[model samples]
Target: MLRSVLAVALLCWGADGAVTCRNENDEPVNWYILYKAPHLTSQALTGLEYVYIDSNVMRKMAPSTDNYKDIKHPNGVLANTLRPLLTPIRSMPNNFGFISYSDQPPGCNAMDTFGHSKGVVMVDNSGPGVWLLHSTPQFPFRRDQNHFWPESGARNAQIFICVTLGYSQFSHIGMHLQYIGAFPFEHDIPLDFHQELRDAVNWVKSPPPNNLRKLISTDVNQPFYSIAKQQSEQPKVGDLYVTIAQLLDSDLQVQTWGCQRDRKPSYCVSGIHKVLNIKDIHTVLGNWQPKHDHSKWCVAENPNNHWTCIADVNRATTQYQRRGGALCFQNQRIKRIFLQVAQGTDDCSTLNIMDTIDCEPDPHTPSLMG
Candidate 1:
């Protein structure tokens, strides 16, 4: 049964014509440049917040990518050029409030300290959360090499996300990076991407406490900790525990879409299907509402089943006069990149990138390139 109870709005949600949110017009909220959540009206729905940095600023600090132009592999293979491109990273560049380390393999590995898989370097700075950096043999044919971020310099194409537990800035709930898939490498970014990142960051920083209480606010009053524990304990593949150390990879595209809303807020869980040591509740998006019916969404686990929550993906949407990476493509033509933290949902439609791109698997092609 759907329960109607008082709750917070942790995600930037939109109603038919309006939305209630915090920081609607605050100057601090103006710090970001992507999308903006409508100012929240209820104090209970104010735990959402987030931020996106310029990855290009960080790219500039790294040795010039052009230096690898003359670089060649031992076998004189064109792919060998990928090595020189990475050689500049022998020492990680410092930019922003983050300190990065480029351990590019073969040396004392500090990145593997977190029980990560072999060959995979961990990107952990004195920031929000630890990220997995896997340099596939696809580019540079090397192992044991990893890069750490430094504090200082510009935030080029890579933006790091810092998630918090409450209003307190001291507590870090989680952290992730929203790598600008197109910008610095190509030199342009969509205005909407910047706006979306800006808006997302704001929501993440000041999340609605209701998101936390929603799952735990029941007859049993079970907290998120318990729910997560229950999900983790259900059953998992041993290989998945080691996937974080494996090369970065993705599954093939499947087409589907739909929308749904429940009187009670719902959640969407993300996980690895084994063979990789990377696993966790990536994000918990909240307070979703869609114009279409819930029947438009589909689930990865159950194709016939409907989906209510939308995974934070590489969106190719655009907003006129907006400035940022997401807006580069006027019609939303970005690759499926990083995942956004999940939020609670009232209604939502699950749209897949393949459906729009016609299931063409190619990261090299950038339609909304920067």
Candidate 2:
């Protein structure tokens, strides 16, 4: 069955074009964004309900819906993304590899120690791997499981963003993923996929840094109790650099951080700048997921800002005490599109992105008390 699937996929590839994910119809796509309708109400679709936004295939951005109103049918997009992997090694291209990373990976990944990051990555020698960031836990099962995302993941709202580029760009992605301690499907990664990360780390740490512009949002998922005690300093995560064409000020990146609703646990927290208080409707997506979920993402509240970012962390009473972050961008088309879905914001914050830099003196914190 797998062999036949690969045969059909090989026949489908344009060969002349770049390697990317397919759309709802299994057609070639340049760049695509998927929003999995959350299982909020009992009527919502179950098991990875996908709302696809493929720029190449579907240019018009639609409102964030809870079902297959966007696509004629809901053919698991992630499943199609992993299809080509099953193709025989000999028939494989030397330039590409796929890694399915998640908090709930194929095995007991023991990822509890890491951040609250979950997603899939596929890189090719041709360019940087496409990182599909999402909220699903155990998903995109192993070959033995028939290469599919399980229904167990359909209980909540989820989001997946896939970006493809050259090897140089992926090196930057590697640096960010490393910050969160994300690995390619754990030790189960194949040899072809190994070089992607090895090369990325070596390249990023090399003398001439790529310094590529991209967003690296994530949730560290550290407990407030541990932070209150002297057990560990705050998570030392990296800040993403923004170089959008319309946004002139370097300070814009600082404002995007404002969207984070929680206060910074310590100075070692992610990003060197401050977090902003974003009330813009764009970021205020209407219960964007099953229960106002997929905490990390960026969005442009107004045209004056000309920037948008969707993150995976929330600053609500419960989540503010947790850990997470998001990536931002100045791309007009993307910014405008996401703005349309600006339904509502799950949580809100009064602290500016910059203000969150310093840790609030808390009696629970041993250092603060001492």
Cα-based lDDT for every prediction = 0.18, 0.42
User: What is the alpha-carbon lDDT of model 1 when measured against the actual structure?
Assistant: 0.18
Please provide TM-scores, in order, for all candidate models, with all chains considered together.
0.19, 0.59
lDDT of 1 by residue, 150-194 (tens): 111011111212111111111221111111111111011112322
Model 2 lDDT at residue 312: 42
RMSD of 1: 22.3
Candidate 2: worst-modelled 10 consecutive residues by lDDT? 222-231
Cα lDDT, model 2, residue 179:
46
Which regions of candidate 2 are displaced past 4 Å? 1-18, 42-48, 57-59, 62-76, 86-95, 107-109, 126-129, 144-147, 186-196, 199-292, 312-326, 344-370
